[model samples]
Target chain A: MIEVKDLSFAYRTGEADAVPALRDLNLKIEPGQLVAIIGHNGSGKSTLAKLLCAVLYPTEGEIRIDGVPVREENQWEVRRRVAVVFQDPDDQLVMNRVEDDVAFGPENLGLPREEIAERVRSSLEALGLVEIGGRLIEDLSPGQKQRVAIAGALAMRPRFLVLDEPTSLLPVPVARRLISTVGDLNRREGMGVLHVTHSMSEAALFERVVVMDEGCLVLDGTPAEVFRHVERLREIGLDVPLAASLAHRLRSRGTPLEGDILDGADLRNALAAVRESTAS
Target chain B: MLELQRNVIFGQFVDTGSPIHKMDARIKLIATFVFIVASFLIDSFLGFALVLPLLALIQLISRVPAGYVLRGSRFFLGFLVFILFFQVLFYPGEVPESSYLWRWGFLSISTTGLYTAGILGLRVIFLYYVTTMLMLTTSLVDLTNGLELIFGPLQRIRVPVNELVLVFVIAIKFVPIFIGEVERLARAQTARGVPFDEGGAFKRARRLGRLLVPIFISGFARADLLTTAMNTRSYRGGRYRTKLRQLHSTATDWLMLLLVVAWMLAAWQLPDRLLS
Candidate 1:
């Protein structure tokens, strides 16, 4: 499990004024958990992701990967265990060839030829990039390049994978398919995933959703648990699904809606059960 | 409107699966070094006559289309010819009166000058062709690995061969990306009615100045990203870095090396004797 102990981070600009990006944020993500951290821009979701990856150390508090506290000396271990796929694929993919790019992480680890080859092959296969392994990265679409970037990270065989707005630049269908692939990876490989996104629908797909507002995590629970805070999420400049919004409004007007409502289907089921109970 | 990626053919590898393409990159690098040396050494017309066929043969065996060479060299070739004209017109060497074809004081065109210009032209042309073919056939990764393994002995002198190779490989790999960015920036300017194509050199450069600043900013930003990405991927220079693929030298590679040596020797010694 990856654990955060009251993690807080601030960027120092000028001497006296250090901008706080994360304020006493605590999160626990176990392996195979599909968790989404949702917030508007500058809400510290990405800050938390970077802290977990050890790309940026916390100004205060700690992030422990598999029980070891993340620090400068052991940052390499954190990197190996927690792989991050940043926003732009073009920025991360350094190699021209797809297979070579995928092999980059393992290559850096200095694995033997056979092991590296196996990892590259398997990673390519995992991302459905087997056929285009030899293709140039320039020739690939933005979505395909994103897939290649993920494949490179996967080759590291990290226990936790963090995606910080990976679908922001991708088309809708491509982003959906990529997310579905990521979901399958989380289940099949049983790696912990923290998907940091602003899309409410995308966040809803996760088993757990964490809401961030102004550098603090405001809500953390199942999607239904989190989405039920429609007015609260709206106040924080984030959208909620329409059904959840309706459910929240109805519950405010003295309706006995007890469960977390995520979608139209969940709202319909709850309303039907409520009507049947009233008739009985 | 500019398709910069399509326009870029340099430092690109064509996977033709040809005999020459399959040859070991170590041998290719060593042979290319020899070719560079021989290009400067072989001076006679007979020597060039002997070398041209060898390059053409290798090109044919590599299966890389000749259009790549011609298209890539068009501007360079034109510039070379123009430089050769000036070189012949103002030949600075001891131009004996007997070798002068037409005399007008310092502006005479001499047979010796023409001969020297011809030799210079051939040397540069061959150098460009051979190196271009090497790049077209050998992938950058193979080239990097080849250089590292070939220069593996230099680490005893604390040469940092692997880091140097990384720099070289990354620079070469960034060529297409850099070009694509220029295209994107240029197209963006064009879309905003900046008029990139409608200007003299001075005005064009002024417009390009606008593009250059952003390219540099983006370039620095990309370099930062690449560094962080490599770091997150656990890249710590060349030490403790292992390659997934190993290059093996086949009999064909040995044969190709042998042929290059034979050609070099022949071009060095047999030129005047055989042709005379």
Candidate 2:
């Protein structure tokens, strides 16, 4: 299990005034679970992600993995456990070639040559990037580069994967494919996932959703339960998915839809069921 | 043309199959020194005639284009022209034989002056081609490795050969990055309506100052991140380091090296008066 208990952070050594990037935040996540953290920009989503991966030490409180606290002494181990896919793919790719880039993390651990090769092949295969393994990272498209970044993290074989807006800048279809790939990894490989996103559509696909407001976790629950609090979500400058919005509007029009209509196809089916009932 | 051809020296590795490329870099460095000495020794017109053909033959064996060498030597050409003009116009005393190539007002040419200009120009050309060939064919890694090997004896005096090699590797890697950054900064300055070309000397200097601010800022930011990444990978100082590509000597390399040594000896043994 991964746990963050009352963690806060500040970056204040520069000319910029000291300001808390993350307030007193706390959360716990078990293995093999997909959790979505939704928040606007500068609402502490990225800072929390960095802290979880041990990229930045928490200024106060403690973070632990399986009861072992994350401190300076155990940072390398923590990093090996939790792999972070950064927002920018350019910053994450350490090598020029695709295969070399994917093998970077494993090589850093000083793995044997054969083992590194095996990990690189398996990671590329997992991300469906086997064909582009020999190509350079700069030659790949934005979506392909994002997949390559994910493959690099996968090569490390971390138990928990933290992605900070992995598909926020991608086209809608590419984002869908990336999230579906994440879903596959979560289910098939038994890896814990913390996907930070601003898209309501993407967040609705997660098993659990946590919303942040002004550097604090304001709400945390299942997607359906969270979306039910429509007014609260709006007050925090967030939105519900289109399907949920339409379902709520229909309910206000004296035609209630049953079950949580989060996806577009589900909403269509629910509307069809309602029409059948009215005809009868 | 000079301003545009500045990137020619930055021609990193073209993989030409020239004699310079075939020889071990250690041997090449020695050959370059010998060739430079020969150019200086042979100051007569006949000597230049022999040296130019030899330079051309070297270029042919390397398979690198001749235009590249010419383009890479632009600054050297300018400097050579300046030196030639100084020697021809201001040689202290009176001329023994005034050979008027072109009498343009106060400027008059003499046989000694013409000979001086020819020798100096030919020597400069020889130097440029030798250096260009060395850089074009040898990879930066191989060059550093060769340097370390050539200076291996200095290790007895506590010289840091490995540290020097590492520094060269890092410098070569950062050169391209720094160039790209300067290009970006220049573009940003241009976008701000700062005409870098149309300014007086001081104005141009001030414009450069404005451009450096952001470049340094971004460069420091990148350096901090790179240092963190390097530290995370445990990149300590080079001690007990193993290389992925080891330098191996071949029969062809040895043969070419022998030929160069024999030629250098023959040239040096030739009568000094004939050589001049």
Candidate 3:
């Protein structure tokens, strides 16, 4: 499990006063849980992702990865436990070739060649990128490049995978495919996922959804529970998923939709139920 | 109109999986240096006949097409020929009477001048071939590992060899990226009515310079992102860092090294005896 206890982070800008990015955030992620973080730009979602991966240290409180505190001394351990995939696929991939880029993480950890090769193979296979393993990273499509980035992280064999806005640059279908692949990894491998995204639709797919606003964790619940707070979410400059918005509209029109509808399937079932009621 | 991608193939590596391609990169690097230095040592055309065959043998082992290598060097071949022409026409230091074939006001052609130009041209070709072959055979990761290993001892003297190696790696990796960026920038400018190809040399250069602003800004942005990526991957420089693929020289590598040493010795000594 990953635990964040009263974690606060402030960026030391040029001036004497530091800009606070996160304030006393408390959270816990159980193993194999798929969690999505949603917020507006500069809503501290990226900051929280960074802190979880120890890219940025918490100014106050502590972050413990698999029970090891995220300090300078335990940095490697923390990194080994939690690997992060950043937004831009081009930026994250350091190697020219796909296999080499995937192997980069394990190589940095100083694993043996055989082991690194094994990890590279397995990670590529896991991401369905075995065919492009030998190809140049520049030649691959943006979706494939992002998968390569994730494979790079997976090769490290981290317990928790933290992806910060991974699909922001990807096309809608490509982004959806990428998320499903990630979801498959979480389901099959039992890997804990902390996905930070701006897409309400994407957020609604997760098992749990967390919302950040003005450097504070304002809402935390299941996707259905969180999407129900449509007005509150809108107040924070965030949108509800399409289904949830439709449900909210229907409720406002006195259709009496009983529950939160965060996905297309849910909306379909709910609409069918309404039709059956009216027909009866 | 300039096919930048086609022209910039200096560091393009071909994965032929040949013996030379599989040879430890450090050994290849050392051998390249030895061969280049040996190229300068050969004084006679007879020596070059011996050396050129050896170079051809290395190229053969690398399995990269000789035509491809030659095509890659086509951009610089014009410059090389121009320099050779000037060297042959203008005998700078001294002109022996017996060696002079033709004479004009300040330009003269001599046997010595011809020989000097030929040797200089051969030197340029050999140097280019050696470096190009090295790149053609070795992947960038292997190249970086080889560089770090070769310069590994310098770390004791606080030379920051790892950082230097990273700089080299990043610089090399960015060549194709920047080339593509320039292409895109040029295309955008072309859409905006910039005549990139219809201009004279000066106009073309100035128009090309206009593309640099966006490329540079994007380059800086990329550098920023790359820095974060590198740091996130736990790149703390060369200190206490270990490699996944520990470079181990094979029997072929050793044999190649030995052959290079022997060739260097022969090239150094045989040229004088043959020339005299």
Q: In TM-score terms, which candidate is top?
A: 1
Residue clash pairs of candidate 2 = B18-B62
Residue-wise lDDT of candidate 2 within B58-169, one digit each (tens)?
7888897777767766756766787788778755235554465555556767666777777778777777777667767776546766788888788889888867775665
> Model 2 chain B: which ten-residue window has the lowest total lDDT?
B1-10
Task: Report how far off residue B127 is in candidate 1 (Å).
Answer: 2.8
TM-score of chain A of each: 0.93, 0.94, 0.96
DockQ for each of the predicted structures, in order?
0.68, 0.16, 0.46
Question: How should the candidates be ordered by DockQ, best one leading?
Answer: 1, 3, 2
lDDT of 3 by residue, A104-168 (tens): 88878877778888999899999999998888887789999999999999988889999999999
True contacts kept of 1: 0.79
Worst 10 residues of 2 chain A by lDDT: A88-97
Docking class of 2: incorrect
Tell me which of candidates 1 and 2 scores higher on DockQ: 1
Per-residue lDDT tens digits for candidate 2, residues A179-218, read: 9999998898899999999998899999999999888998
- Angstrom error of the Cα, residue A115, model 2: value is 1.5
lDDT of 1 at B155: 97
